[model samples]
Target chain A: MEFTLISLLNGVTYGLLLFMLCGGLTLIFSMMGILNFAHASFYMLGAYLAFQLSAWLGFWPAFFLAPPLVGVAGALVERYGLRRAHRHGHVAELLFTFGLSFLAVEMVQLVWGKAVVDYRVPPSLEGTLFTLYSTSFPVYKGFMMLVSVGMLALLAALLAYTRTGLIIKAALSRPDMMQALGHDVPRIFTLVFAGGAALAGLAGVIGGNAFVTEPGMAAAVGPIVFVVVVVGGLGSLLGAFVASLLIGILQTFMVGWDYSIIDVARLFGMQLHSTSALTRLSLTQLAPIMPYLLMVAILIFRPRGLMGARS
Target chain B: MLEVNGLHAFYGKSHVLHGVTLEVGRGEIVSLLGRNGAGRSTALKAIMGLARAEGSVKFKGEEIAGMKPHQIAWRGLGYVPEDRAVFPDLTVRQNLLLGVKDPKAPGRFRLEEMFALFPRLEERALVPGGVLSGGEQQMLTLCRTMMGNPDLVLVDEPTEGLAPLTVAQVAQFLLEIQKRGVSILLVEQKLAIALDISQRLYVLGHGRVVFGGTPAALRENAAVRKEWLEV
Candidate 1:
């Protein structure tokens, strides 16, 4: 029972991290209908930026400073890259962002090298909060929770109450009306893209040290993040939140499910040798495909996604 | 004043407005009368620069043919689209906020002024525009344009799909707007409303202006109505 609780806590933490990264992607894509393939590359950039900032200015400063820096970079991309590509159509924008992601990943590798850089937890957040059934829950994980919740609140308030938020919400629902109302729709798009990039950068700052910071980390987590956005209805923040939690918990629990294919076969009165392909099929081998499977299932059942409007 | 001299507009390869020329003096309500598919809406769109247009389009002695829609709007031209393009997700207050495009010191309606003009909108400040009745949406669109405090407004089919009472209400609102020293380029299918409200009228057919004259002259010319307006 205690183990189950630990797993649940672990899942929630991980889910929140996924939410931090994916919330931006979902907003940018759903609202703007720009499939930003390089979104994960921005995540990798955030991690590296935090690492560089930490080396010079310490962990606390990196946390405070790196996200806004990343946001500026995102704004530049929106202004010069995405905005220019926008005139060519959504497909061109997608391709441009996809190329950007490739370029970002390569740039990170060139700057940081191909090795896993050691990124330690900050001294203030070091060590465990408590031990549960011989397993320790790190204080850093708690800190992560606080950050994610704070960010989620800030985002909610920004979307619900502010004038810019009101504009974004209206534009998301009725883009044509926004134009008819004499809004420079392109400027709004740039703001949203930058804001989304900043959110992804914030996730990277916190998650990089907790997870592994490496050049290839973007490729590793990219599909999973996209899966979260897809599972959450496209352009629906509520759906994204729910899907994040679901995927987070599922991925966490699947890690410890010990029953193998052979065990399942044995329960049905069958045997397989070590050399057999059936026995060779390991759980870890199937782990990466699990989210994709869920994504496909969700797509088949609800094409508009959980919170997406039919129109 | 607003003027279109040999204005040409197109949608892809198909020409939608051809050599359409007309004018509206300040404090005047001018109507564009045409049958369905006669390019009245396209002409309005061309003036607003929302549609692709060629040739001279001028407002207040300034060239506006190649300007963007927002730029044209910033220059005191308001547009009410045929479909009643209200921001469906926004509250009435928020919708009113988008209408004010100018930063000038004179000729702007404050938020409270708009509320007084459309009290229904003030009551529904927090309500979504989409849920409003058709007549309410029409009023909201017109009031939202007035919120920008534009000098000249282009209204397209404001009475379309409206009951007779609601249509009368809209007509009254347009008259009130005109009394405020603003010019209007009104597009309408209802001849009665156009003839009743407009000082001058232009008849369009097959993407061209077939006739231009006073509203009384339009009403008097049986051949013009029979050839261009009547189905």
Candidate 2:
């Protein structure tokens, strides 16, 4: 039971990290109508930048500086890359982002080399918070939770209260109408793309230390983030939040469970353990597939996902 | 205030507008009257550079033949699309707020003034636009456009698919806007409503302007209406 609870918290933390990355991705996709494959790459860049900055400054300052730097990179890409590719239609835009992701991953390797960089938790937040039975949660993880909550609150407030936020909200609903209403929609798109990248970057600053910071980390994290967004539903923030938490808890609990199909079958008195390839597969190996399985089920049952409505 | 000379607009390979020329003076309400498929909406779109077009368009004595839709809008011209493009997820108050254009704006509309203009909208200011009836959505679209305080407004088929009472209300709203000295380019199918509100009329058919004159002249000329507008 303690094991389960510990793993559940572990899953929630990871899920929150994914949410940080995916929330920006959802906003970008809705506002720009481009599936930005480079989004994960940006997250990776954030980690690398934070790692580099943390060596000079501290972890907290690196956290502040890295996101905006990544945001500037995102703004430049919008001005040059995405905007140029936008003239070629949705497929072209997707391809452009896909190519950019490929390039960014390769660039990371070229600059940082192939090995994983040691991204340690800041000394200030390096200890345990408290013990429960035999398990203790790390102080750094508690700090991560605090930071994520603070970021979410800041974003929610900005989106809800500011004029620019109002424009973004309006644009997300009706982009052409936004254009007609005399808002410089291209400028708005640039801002949204940058803002999204900044969020991803911020996620990277925290998540990089929590997870492993490597050139190939994007490949590992990217598909899961996509699954989170798709499971959450496109163009819906509330859906994203729900899916994030759901996936988090699901992943956490699944990892802790030690039961197998064969064991369950034996318990139920259906002990037909013929040597099939399916039965040979370990429950440990199935952990990675859980989110994808859930994604497929969601897709089959509800085509627009949990919150999306076909218009 | 606006002039289109030899305007040519195309949709893919099939041409929708061909060599159309028209003009609207300052503070005048000009109506483009035609039956469906007569390129009435296309003309407004073409002039606004919303459609793929090739021709000469002049506004305020400056040639604006090949500008983007937003650029055209930024030049003090606003378009209300035929479908009444209201942001369904937004509240009525938010919708109105979205239309204010000035970069350094200072409370463009007193909420009371707008409420006085459309009491129904005021009553449901916080309601999401999707829940509103078709008539209310149309009013919202118009009110939203006027909120920008534009120099010239391009309104496409404002009376389409509305109840007669709502149509009358929209007409009154247009007149009120005109009273505020805003020039209007109205693309409409209902000839009666078009004639009621417009100072001049242009009838289009097969991507060309078949007739252009006053409402009285258009009413008297049976051949023009029969050829271009009558079903």
Q: Kindly list the per-residue Cα lDDT of model 2 for residues B1-231, writing each as its tens digit.
A: 998999888877879988999998888999998878888888888887778898899999888778776777778788899998888878898888787787466433455677798899999999998899989999899888877878889999998899999999999988888888889999988888999889999998899999999999999999988777778
Per-residue CA lDDT of model 1 for B1-231, tens digit only, reads 998899899877889888888899999999999999899988888888778889898889999889877777778889899898887877777777767664355355677876787788789888988899998899889988888778999999999999998999899989998988889999998999999999999999999999999987887899999999998
TM-score of each: 0.93, 0.95
lDDT of 1 by residue, A1-311 (tens): 88689889988999998998888998888676866888887788888899999999999999989888888899899999888888899889889988998899788888888899877789999999999989999999999999999999999999888877877887777665566567777688778888889889988999999999998888988998888888888877888899999888877777766667787688899986667776766555655677899999988998777776641
Candidate 1, residue B196: how far the Cα is off, in Å: 0.6
> For every candidate, what is the interface RMSD in angstroms?
1.9, 1.2
Best by TM-score: 2
Q: DockQ of every model listed? A: 0.51, 0.74
lDDT score, residue A299, model 2?
Answer: 84
Q: Clashing residue pairs, candidate 1?
A: none
Error of 1 at B61 (Å): 2.7
- Judging by lDDT against the true structure, name the best candidate: 2
